[model samples]
Structures are given as structure tokens and as C-alpha cells.
Target: MFPLSTSINLTLPIEDPILKFLLILVIILAAPLILNKLKIPYLLGLIIAGAVIGPHGLNLVLRDSSIILSGTAGLLYIMFLSGLDMDMSDFKHNSWRSLVFGLYTFCVPLGLGILAGHYLLGFPLYSSILLAGLFASQTLIAYPIVSKLGIARDKSVTISVGGTVITDTLALLLLTIIVGMATGNVDDHFWWRLTLSVVLCIVVIAVLFPLLAHWFFKHVSDNISQYIFVLALVFLGAYLAQLAGLEPIIGAFLSGLALNRLIPRTSPLMNRIEFVGHAIFIPFFLIGVGMLIDYRAFFRDWESIEVAAVMILLITAAKYIAAFLTQKTFRLSKDQRTVIFGLSSAHVAATLAAVMVGYNVILGYTPEGEPIRLLNESVLNGTILMILATCTISTFATQRGAHNIAMGNAQESDDDRSRRPEEHILIPVANERSAEELVAMSIMLKKPRDPNGLYALNAIDNRVEDPNVEKRARKILDAAASAAAGSDIYLQTLLRYDVNISNAIVSVARERNITDIVMGMHHMTPAVPGIAGIPVPAGPAIGRMAADVLGHSNITTFLYNAEQPLSTVKRHLIVVPEKAEKEAGFQMWMNRIHQLARNSGAKIIVFAPASTMPYLRTFGRRRPANIDFVVFEQWDDLPSLEHDLRQDDCLWFVMSRRERVSYHPAMSRIPLYLEQYFAGYSYVLLYPVQAGPGDSRYL
Candidate 1:
């Protein structure tokens, strides 16, 4: 290590705006990284850094207006994200449990706080009620912890997020009413106004926001534009809530619930949302909270210590009891109980909001002329200490509980070693528009958390010696990779030169040991002059390159003709060949279609032979009864089914190569049929991997 410099060149509390921003950025970058190695939570490190560099500490940076602005945005951003990332399915499954837990966590602390304030600390009625409101509310300051750890969707975590909704809303409502009561604003008309305004707020957020978002997504495809639209909606909801007498964070979260289904977890847009929030807004807010700390107050006086100790004990104990009751009531495991407690115990967000409201509500004056506020300075100082201690506890407990749950899951996974082999999907992008759709579809088709499986390739013909060929190819592949990046999945991009592009594609597939190749449908080189005299056949339905790829390689491949966004599709129409159930890739292709259906909230409508019906049922037993099949054996009549392919329907036409298990003489005429009838519809022409020596290892 280099020796420390002896000379001191800088003065304390530097005030250059740019320099201060640069300093905060440096701290945000280094603090978490440096503390991560010591196995401490990086969040804890950020808070500590804020305290060290804040106005109360060394004063290297003042808690200025800019910091407050960014911090407020960060706080709102975090709340919005929690709503956006809520695992709705789990939350729905445990909805009642969430409500119960919400009441338990709320009522317990609230009661204790009221008693401690009125009897123990000897405060008045409304003042005690306000103090209880602070204890009753919590901020999910540690939610980012589980989200980063990849357990955000765990049942316990989902329930905790759901409970947050109930508890925080109730707590905030209580704060509003108590404040109105203290200020003599609570009356018959006041109740009527609050009720109507809240109902209107709920309706606007839950109903109007989704309708508006759907309209926007239908019209706008730009990722950046969509992100801005989402942010606009989040803040809009917050401001609307303020209009209806609620806090902005509540509005932010409600906005998330309304827009949940509109955003898929694997979408690039979701990735971008998380990336920007974590990188800037969330960190700024965390540091701002840290800057509020005055640790000296805890040591300088006994009243600060007394209030801090009592507040911390009451909240922690009450939260733990609530978690225990929820665990016993729901039959959750000890780890899950710990997780719930860890998540609900932290005091921030609504707690801070309550404190500020109470501190600002000056009712009268005391004998000594010190303002007799709802909550005095001692409690205000105690509130800061409570935030610091509770947040620290929240981080450590969440990390430990999540670790235990993850290790247990890993052990359970170890017992299933005979699961399907990993998948590596190869996508050959045609253009920017098609590439985004292809990548989005591929992301859903590929298994979640498949680290090394997604690859986007652009094969340039070496016959064209222009220097610009490679440049154009790189751009196409980069476009595909960008789509993947938004979803937080790495796309290994390849730009290769070969005399024959199809041959290059096949060679790359072999080198990568790729399992599936996705090719987009477009007019490439025309087919060879057809039938000496008869009118030359229209160009190949699926591109010549795509046909060559299907014929040259036996691996599974999909020829996609995407006419609209995958998110907009409403139904899947799967046309299975007669002997398709016997094909080696039958199960594999079925899994892909099922995964797509599940992700898109669509149902499968099958047109297959009656003999294939049992196998379809057996394969999709775990799925809901969303399938409706018809006996569609006559290949000659496939063209008449054009009436069945609606604008929102995706056709999955399964075919096979000559002499393959499911191959039929009619299958050879697929190109003529697709070009004749299916040009305007969205479809996937699927060719399952042909049965061969190693083909028995199906997914």
C-alpha cells in the first residue's frame, strides 16, 4: 500500500456544486463496494457514509436543496419500485394472510405506542395517538436487500410487500385524521370529504392509470420514451394522492399496483427501470436519510436516550410479536417469520412523515416559552436514532433470513439433478424492429437465470468485401443485445464473415452447442425458377436462409413473423401435426409455447389430431384448463383456418423435415401455403429437433 500524503491541501466543508456532486458519486460508488467484503450490508455503508460526510458530521457537504430533491425522488422511486416489482401471483395467493399480517403489525405497535405515550411518557390524547401512528407505520427500507438477493418473489417477501400496502395506508390515514382533530378540522363534512376523496383516488390510480398505460404501450415502442411515461405516471399518482389527502409515497405504490400486469418481469423496460432507480435515485435517498443523523444528541442528553430506547423497544418488540402471530396463523416456517419481521420492523417513510407532521403541528406554548408541539425536540431527536438503529437491524435480519431460505432452496434443487439440460438460444436478428420483438420473445422462451444461453448473431457474407459490411452487422447485433440488456440478461453477440451466411450460422450453432435458433421471417433471395414453364412461385414464405437453416440443422428452430408486440397478443393457436406427439422435440416445443402463454396471460387453442390430445393433456397437466382442441387432421384444409387467426392470435404451426417422425407429404408444401394465406398474421413456424443419437435428452 502507498503511504499516506503528509500535506493537507483541501479545506473543510467544500461547497463547489460540481465537486460536491462528484464527491457524493464517489462515496456512492466506493462505500458499498468496500463494505461488501466485510459481509456488512451495503445499505448500512451508504447511511454511515452520509453521516460521516453530512452537515452534522465533518460538513464536507451540506444537506442542501439539491440533495433533498434527489433524496425525495429516490424515496418515491423506491416506493414505486416495490409496487412495480411485487410478485402479484404470490400476493394474490396470500392476500388474506397479508391483510391479517397488516392488521397485526399495525394494531400491536399502535396500541403499545398509545399506552406508552399516555401512561408511561404522560403525553395527552391526540399527542399519544400521533405517537402511536408513527410506530404503526413502517418503511420497506430493506426491500432492496431481498430484491437484490433474488428473493423478492418469495412467499414471505411478497406477503410483506402486500402488508406494507395495508399498514402504511392505514397509518397515513390515521395521521391525517389525528392532525385534523388536533387542529379542530374534524367534522361531519370532513369525514364525507375524506371518504369521497379517497375512493376517487383509488379509482383513478387503479383504473385510469392502467387504461392510460395500455394506450401508451400500444402506441409507443421506444424503451426510453416508455420509461419516461412510467415515471410520469408514478409522480402523477403521487400528486393526485396529495390532492385526495394522502402522501405521495402511497400514490407511488398504488400506481405500481395498477400498472403491474402491463409490465413483464423479463422485459427490457423493467430492466431499465431498476437500473436507473438503483444507480441514482435510491442511493441519493439513502444518503440523505443518513445525513439527518446527529449521533451527538444521543450521547449529550438523557431524555434523547430515554425516548430513543422506549421507541426502539416498543417498535421492535411489537413488530416481532406481529410476525410470530402471522407465522403461527399462516403456518409459515421460522425463516419466513424472521423475514416478515425483518421487512416490517424498519421505521422510515411513513414514520418520518408522521414525525414531521407532528413536530410541525404547534398547538400552543409551554410555561418556559419553548413551543409546545405535538412531539417535542427530545422525541424529534429520538426519531433520528430510531431510524438509524431500526434500519441497521432490518438489514442484518433480512440478509440472514434470505440466506437461509436460499440455501434451503439450493438443497432442494440438488435433489432434482436429473432435470433438463441447460438451454442456449441463438437468435439471428433481421432488423431493429424485428430484433426487439425477437429478443423479447426469446427472453420469455429461455429459462429464467440462464446466464450463458442467450446469443444474438449477425453473419455477414465474406463474398461482399466492403469494409462497411462488418460495421452494419455489428449494429444489428448490438440492437439485439440492447433489447436483452434492458431485461438484465447478457446477450453474447457474434459478427462473423463467411462465404455462405447459412453455413456460417450452422457452424456457429455447432460451436456454441446451441439448443434452439430463432429466425425472423423476411424475403431473402428468391427461390430457384419453379416448374420450367408455370409462373415462378412467389419468394419462399420463410426466408431462403431460414429454410436452409431448418434443413441443414436438426435442432429445434422457430421462424417468427411478428406483426405486433408480443405483449399485445391475446391467444395462441397451436396447429400440431398428426404424428407430432411422437417427435423428439415435442415436449421441448410444448414447454416453450406453454411458457409464452403463461407469461402473456394467453390461452392455447390447439388444432391437432385426436390421437395427439392425450399427450397434450398429460404434458400440460400442471397448467390451468385454458386449452381447447379441435380434430384438425386434414392438412389440405389448413388454409381455410385463416378465419381462426385473429389479429391478436399467434399461430404455432408445427412441421417436420422429410422422413422425420412427424413428417407428412403435405408438410413439404408448407412454404406455398404460408406465403399464400398467412402473410398478414403473427405466427411461429416450429421445426422440432429431429430424433437422432443424442435427441432423447428432451426438456
Candidate 2:
């Protein structure tokens, strides 16, 4: 290895702010691709990059004020998101478990760290205690990976996240006391001030912030303004926490909890908040953490290596012990225990803060008359190494554990494996006025347990090059998305420029693996005579686009023509054709209808062959819905249901595509029949996609 002197002078520090920012951006962009290819977690890669470019390495970039500001913002953003993304309902339900895990995670690490610091490293009593607290605090750097895997709602993850709040709070509180004592201000007055200020701060953030946010959201009309308002609240909460003699992160976390209900998990506002934090703030903070490390310190001093090794070993052992005990107590799987350990193993934000505070304080004097620092450079370097090791371990452990858990869950139920194939529903928005109804229908039909979301498409004709057309299309889709958001449904807005709207819808549906397509019923206008003589009757039949989509798409499709709002409908009148129960998409349609009935609180009365009634009853029994069967005995007798159908009732026709097993000649006469006898009532015509031969089971 080259001498430290030569390495330190090899590179000049970059003084330009723009250059510094560009370097960081480049690192962020390139590190993930390279590290992912190498099978290294991108988060760990960032920290390594920070070390390489840090001042202690080649001295390329100094740790400047801008970096500090951005890093601080990022730290707060991570904490805020941790609280915001947590499933509040699950967290509350598992609060007691969280407390148990919190105590275990905190006490084990704190006890182990103190022993290592005092006996192994020969640190003073107060210094050992502070170091112990540092070891107890863990940053949830692996949470984003858990979320991306779509298992954030898992019981193990929920318990871990809940426990994080408790452990981190206790650690930070201990840090505050340590700092107060080291600075010679740990008096009764200090305790009183801290207690009162913290209590008041909690009340304001928990009670007042939510009240204010609720009022603001109710009054705020602009989506962008609403986003900005929430961001402002986050920082304001952080600032208030600082004023109350607590860390700003505490305020950010509390702020997230306060606004959790007001900002639905699937809302556009939540999307924007996460987008900004992940894209900018959090990355900057992570890079800042890297910049603090000096790679040369390890080579210059062997004591640094020993310190790092001890810290890592103690921290890892303590975390595992805690996880092991928790797993045994809760009877969790080995993978779940591993996941808890992984999620709680990383050391960052809180650890670094505590270390820095200790490093700055003057503890006592050495025997040689030199001032003894609470935390020396060796300890700091060791902490950096500890951060890297724990982060790598956490990433790998969490990834492996989460994957195993998911795979185990998938394997436990064959029915779930077959039925739950990422239910993505696509809705093509055509008429601005009816788009909301289409989206609402998609929401109702979507599998309640599915994590997949709805996609709202607005296809603009390629011939229309005007930007204004695309703008109008986006506005229509946005309105639909906003309507879905109100019901806590996640809807992704997609815009496409295609010559044929039907082709665009089909392409998007295939690309997104759309399980169901919901679209509004449109009527085709008659063609001029001789130019293009009416190929199909246009007056009462479906439009060309709707017909084309239905003909081309293999997925289940629903065409709705509502006489009144679906919410106002009092009853559902469903007519099922002969052999409909044998169709592959039968179960899917049945599930949709059951979900719709549940959502609308409408009583479902099905008219079908007596043979199909048993299957329908079995489905109702298994799924549990309010449905009644009426034996019609004939497919041609669907028009007879007009006598039972009321104006407020929704008439549903479970028809089949042409040449399908459930298709009947009477299916072609549905449009004409509806127009002649049931034009005043809301109606839905469903065409179940063709399923495989073996997919005809009742399950």
C-alpha cells in the first residue's frame, strides 16, 4: 500500500459547489447500476462512494455547509417517511409486540455495548453509557427494499417498524441525557424542562398538527399546494422538536403520524411526498454519511480496526439475541426472525449523531495532563466501519428473509398461487363525465387483498398533434384518478398517442398484465350512405372502439351504461347465460359481482339455469355475499327480467364472447333488448375472458 502522506496529497479538494453537486449526482446515478451488477446493495454502495470521495480519502471534496444542510434534510426525510409509510392500523394492533421487541433490541445492545466500551476498550463510565446508547439506535435503511417487494404490510415488517420508533426514541433520549451530563448541566431543572417541553411538543404535534392538516386539506383545492403544505408541516414539526430540546427527527416522525389519516397511503399527495424524498433528500443524506469516513484511518492505526471489529461483533450479536428471543416468544418463523434482525441491525443517523456529540464533549483529563475526549478519532473511524458492515449485513439479511417469507407464503396455498397473479385492472377513460364511474367500477371489481393498483389510460389519436388535446386527455384522466384517490384507491395515470384508442388500450393492458378492463359503453354514430354503409347497426349496439377492445382483449371486460350513479342504485339484477358457470373467467366475474354487491350494499338477484345456481350458491357460501338465485331455465327469457327490474336497479348481463363455451345466440340480442325494455335502468354487460380448460373449478 502507498504511504498515507502520498495518498492524502494526490487529489485536490473540489471547491466549486456545482462540481461537488455534479460529483454526488454522478455517484448516485452510477453507483447503483455498478453495485447491483456486483450483487452489492446500492445503499451500501452509496456509503462506500461517500468514503472514497470524502475528505479523509483523497481529500477530493470537503464536508461543506451545503452538504450538511442537504444531509440533515435527508436524515429528517428518512424518519418522516418511516412513520408515513407504516401501516398505522397494523402498527397499532402490534403495539405491544413492538414494545417487547423495542425493550429487547435496546437493552441487549446497550448492555453489550457498555461491556465492550468499558472492559474491552477501557472507556470511562459515562462515556461507556453514551456509547451503549449509540449502539442501541438503528436506522431502517432496508425498509425501502421491503416496500419495493410489496411486503411492507407483512406482520413481521409491521412489528419491526413499530419497534424502531420505541428503540430510537429511547436511544435519542439517552443521548440527550448523556450530553446534558457531560456538559455539566444534568440538574433537576434540566430534567423538568426536558419533560415539560417534550410533553408539550407531543401534544402540539399529535393533536394540533393533525387538526391543522385536516382543515388545510379540506380547504386546499390545488394538488401541488397540498403537497407543499404537507412538506412545510414536516419541517415545521422538525423545528418545533428542536425547540423542545429533542432531536428534529422525533418531530418529523410525529408529523408523519399526525397526517397519516389525512394523506391516504395511495393518494397522489403521498406519491409526491415519497418521490421528492427518495429522489433527492434521502440520497443526499446518505452521501453525506459516506463523506465522514476516512479510509486511510484503518491503515494508519490498528486500534481503529480492533475498535470497529468489537463494535460490529457486539452490535450484531446483541441484535441477533434480541431477534432470537422475540422469535421464540412470538413463535415466528426463522425467516421472520432473520428479517427483524436485518431491519434492526443498521447503524446510521442516530448513531452518528450520538457519536459526534460524545466526540465534541470533554470528559476528563488523562494521566499525562492531556484532555481526554469522550470519543476519540479511533472510535469515530470504528463507528464508520461499523456502519458499513451492519448496512451490508442488514441489506442481505433483509432481502433473503423477505424473499423466503414471500416464497413460503406462496407455497402454502395452491389456490392463492393460481388466483393471485398480481391483479392489475386497466380502465380506458374516454368520456370525461363517465370516467369517474368507470374507475369506481374498476375499484369495486379489484381484488381487495391485492397490492396491485389501477391504471387509468387516456389515449389521444395520433392524427391530433395539438398539445392541447393531450392536455385535455391528461386532465380527464387526472379527474378520474382524483376520484379514485378519495376512496383510498391507487390509480396510475397513463397517456398514450395512438392512431386507434382500442389498439392503445390493448397494448397497455398486455404490457401491464391487466386482469380486467372496465370501460364506459359508447354508441356508434351511423355512417353516411354509400361511403361506408352501416356495417353493423349503430343505434342500439356498442361503439366501434368498445367492440374492437372487447374483440381483441382476452382479459375480462365490463361495459357500463349507467342510467343513474352507481352509488344510488338499490339493487343488482344479473342475468347469466347457459353454461356460464363452465367458462374460465366465471370465478373472476363472480368475484367481481360479489365485490360490487358488497361495495354498493345492493342485493344481487341472479337469473340463470338451475345447474348454475348450485355453483353460485357455493361461491356465495365460500366468499360470503348477499346474493339470491332465480332459476330462469332459458337463455332467451332474459327480457322477462324487466318485470322485476326497477328504475333504480342495475341490470347486469353476464354474456360470453363469440365462439366461447357460454355464448348463446340470444347474446347478440342483448343491446336491442336493453334498449327496448330496460333503457331507463342502469346496465352492465360483462364478457369474461377465455380461461384455460382446467380453470372451470368452483374455487
Candidate 3:
């Protein structure tokens, strides 16, 4: 059905509508997937693909038929989606920055445009005013780009996008007023009319759209019909804007804002709308823009090219200057300054539309009639070139630039590093769950303690300075020491003044290289831990202790109450199917278990699957004499011999290594399922030996 080649087309005559629709659909569907695989921007790819299939390029399709209608419809659809993506809540969040940065973007660009038109090209004053207004318009369809980039986790991206929404809205309103005046419609009453219109529009929107939208969404089915209603509102808003002598796009955007507030947070309508927009309209619209490019006109107009380059440089410089000044004036950091500039660099879609409207409808600049209309062509072609260049460059460069700036500022210094917490300190407290808490802490902090061993610490509260407090703490420590009978444990006491006990514990731990720490759960200080310290003065300071012990070295910590017994210690010596020592944690855990068994005079037998012999060889050198290992061929046969080992007073340590799936080994299910059956009799350890740093999830 596609007009692929002349031979096929001539032989198999096809229905035009079906063929056209299929061709467009194919382009829309395939372009993103193909380009996405290549790691290229989808919009850029779509544009190039469109140009390839356009009349001026490969001539694979004609634009005179249904393709043209569909393409135009795609643009409108994309524009509507763009409006919907403009989150007004985001605007409110960054209103101050957006207002300042947006005003700066609009004003600086307009000033440059005036200079370019009036001085550089010597255009009429009124025409220059219109041109300046058009150039000043910059639209940031940030939502889709942010979603695609998957950078919502970055705070800078969130702030920049929030500011962008406000910036775009304010700039559009300013442009509307400027364009209205440029058209010579308003006399001396321009300001009054503009103010009244904005006020009236705001009031009408405030009262009508919100209430109506709220009612509609509250009772609506939130399905295809909801999307249709939104689509209809977009056109209606635009139509209303036209009646008010403002750009229709403004109304469309406003309608979106109203709907955004009214729509439920978990609406299926958004998903369906996003699906249609992203899968079809957006790609098609971008490609259509690319196909419309006039390469010849661009090359022939050297002066226009020069002017365009100058405009870009000037606009960019002006934005940076504004950003720099605003940041400096407000005492904003260097990273914030860079982010502001990056947000300012967003110029596309709306900019092009404004330019086209100005040149064609307002200025009467068209590529027809006498003299070949070189000026009109230059402006039109130049605008397109500028839009693409600015948008792509700004989006990518700003993202990278902002990222670098943020990283540079956020990087930890040695001082910061010193202040950083290594373990989360638990303040000892009396509670019902204190025992369970201790048990959980012991299980979680199973990571090997420092070579020096765990330093069990307690702090004397500043409030009472009672000698009884130390006696009570010592009694708890003695009990813990007895429970951990064979393990190396050291007791330490701190006499404190007015400082937080959590901070004191953390500071001491880092200095001593204390691996895992246990503490009481009671608040005695008001001071919270800094990047380095711990929480002071209240309930078992578990949060503070965890924070302190988290990031230093490879130390994993356990926070347990002094009263509870250690629950479920299963240190599995995992032999990889055909591999040697892999994960450091696995090696440490197994080594510690072997040491415990040897020291306690307990016999430990390793029941491994037959496939793990190659990896077992690595353990023979330091293997404990009381430990013996046997290999089994099948999992079903494990229980028969496992019963014999238990009867022999030997601990059967069955270890399994999983394969790989997203950093976890693939065949982990065998060990996992088997562990469920031998819950208490035998300790089963399922160790996913990380293959490399990239396989960190196994860790």
C-alpha cells in the first residue's frame, strides 16, 4: 500500500487514503523506536526522516493529499498536548525565579531583536516592533523532554522546569500585548486595554473554567471522552483568545491549566493522551517542521545567515548577563546562575509559530509575487534554522552544563567527608519493640565489622550526670557481651557535657574505625547531628546511628537492643557454579562463619550443588578442619542427607549462587525455594556474587 517503488506502485494499484494513512502511521511508529535505538534525539530523527520522504528529498510521498491534512492535524494535536504538559503547580513552586528570569529573557531578546531589525536590516519601526515581539517568544515544552530524559530525580531539573512554565506564560502575555500594539490597532489606550483584557481573562478563568472543570471531572468517566473534552477545550480556548484579539495558543494553555487542577491525580486520561501524543502527533509535527525547510534559501541569503548568527550570540549573551546579574544580586550560587541561563536557552515551537505569524499575517511578508520575495524567504527560512539550532543546542548543552555546575558544587570536600556520618546511632530507650529492633539491627548490620572489631558504646546524659546512668548502661553492656560470647567486643563510656549523645557516639566511631555500633534508645540532647554528627536527646537514636554508620568503608551495621538475642544468623559459603571468589561481602560473611565454627569447636559441613566444584577449590587453602563439604546432584535429594547432618550435630550450611538478572544472578530461585523448607534446622545462604561493579545490585 505504501508508494515504495514505481514497479510495485504501477503493478499493485492501491487505495490512496489507506496508503497515505499507512505511510504516515509507519513513519510515526517506526521513527522513535529506530532513532531511540541509535541514541539520537527522536525529534531530530523524525525531521530528517520527513525531509528524506518529502518531495524535495527522496520524493517517496506527496504532501498534496491526506498526508498534508494529517500533518497539520498532528501539529495542532502536539500543541494541545504541549499545553496540557504545562503544569501550573510547577509555576507556583518557582514563581519568584520564573518571574525574574522570564522577564529578563523576554526583555533582553526583544531589545536585541529591535537592534537587529532596525539597525542591522533597516526595517520600518512598526514592522521592527512586530519582529522583536516574535523573536522574544520562547516556548519550553519541558515536561516531555524531562520525562524522556528521566531526570526528574534531579532537583535542578525540577526547579528549572518549574521556572520555565512561569517564564513561558509571562513571556506569551507580554508578546500578545506587544504584537497587539505593533499591529497599530490600539491608540494611546494600549496599556489600559491590555490591563483590562488580562484582568478580565483572569477573572473569567478564575470563576468559570475552574468551577466547570471541577464539576465535569468529579462526575466524568475519565476515559476517551475525557480526552476528547480536553481536546475540544483546547480549540475553544484558542477560539476565545482569537475573539479577545490575543493569540489562540494562550487560551489553549489556560484551558490546560484549568483541566490540570480539575483532573484527578491518578486519571487514566493523562496516560491515554500521552500515549497518542507521544506515539504519533509529536514525532509527526517535528518531522513536518524539518520537511518544510528550504535549504537553498538558507544558503543563498548570506546576509540573513550572518544576521541570524549575530542574533543568536547576542540573545545568548544577554540571557547569561541577565542570569549573572540576577544571581549575583540575589546572592545565588554559581550553580543556580548556570541553571537560570540554561532555562533561559529554551527557544522553540512557540518562537517559530510567532515568527511565522508575524512575517505572514501581520507584516505581509510572503515568498510570492515580484522580486522573488527574498526578504520574506530569508526571515521564514532563517527563523526555522534558528529555532532548530537554538532548541537542540540549548536543551542538550544546558542539561550538561547545569549538571556539571550542580555536581561541582555538590562534591564533598575532605572537611565534608570528615563530617559525614558512618553509622546510624541508636539511642538506648525502653520500649515494647526494643528487642525486635535490636534483632533487626543485628541482621541488617551483618556486614563484617572493622578489623579492630565492634566498639560497644554508651553516653552519659548531660541533664542528670547521674553515676547510676553509667551503672545501668554497664549492666546492659555486660548482658550484650555475654550474649555475643565468642565474638570480639569492646566496651567504652563517654562523659558528656551539653553535646548530643548521638553526635558523640558517631564522632567516636569514625575516629576509632568502629565497624558496627549498638546504643540505647533515649534522647538526652537537643543538638541534631550535622552532616557528621548524630541526633541528640531522645528515643533510641536509631536514625542518627544509621546515618553515622552508613557510608564509611564497606562496614554494614546492626542496631539492636541490649535485651534481645541475635536472630537467624545464616552465613552461607556460596560456591559459584563454575567461578571463584566474587563479592567481597560474600567472602567476608563465609570467612567469619568458618572462623566462628572453628573457634567454637562446632563441626560445619558445606552441602553444595555438584556444579560448584571449580569455585570450591579457592576455599581449600584456609579451610577449617572441623568443616567438611559434599556436593549434591539434585535439590529434591538434599533433604534426605540434610536430616543425617542434623542428627550428627553438624551444622549444614547450604550455599547457592544465583545467575544474572539486573545485577542479580539468574538461577537464584533454586536456593531461595530450598531455603524455605529448611527454615530452622539448616542455615541456607543465597549469595548472588556480583560479577563486577556493574553488577552491584547483587551486593
Worst 10 residues of 2 by lDDT: 527-536
**lDDT, candidate 3, residue 282?**
65
Clashing pairs in 2: none
Instruction: Arrange candidates by lDDT, descending.
Output: 1, 2, 3
lDDT of 1 by residue, 589-626 (tens): 88787666545545578898888888887776754434
Clashes of each: 1, 0, 42
User: Per-residue alpha-carbon lDDT of model 3 for 173-223, expressed as tens digits?
Assistant: 655655566655667687777667766765565567756654565456435
TM-score versus the correct structure, for each prediction: 0.85, 0.66, 0.50
Residue pairs in collision within model 1: 268-486
* Maximum-lDDT candidate: 1
Tell me how candidate 2 scores on lDDT. Answer: 0.80
C-alpha lDDT of candidate 1 relative to the true structure: 0.82
After TM-score superposition, what is the CA distance of residue 557 in candidate 1 from its true location, in Å? Answer: 1.7
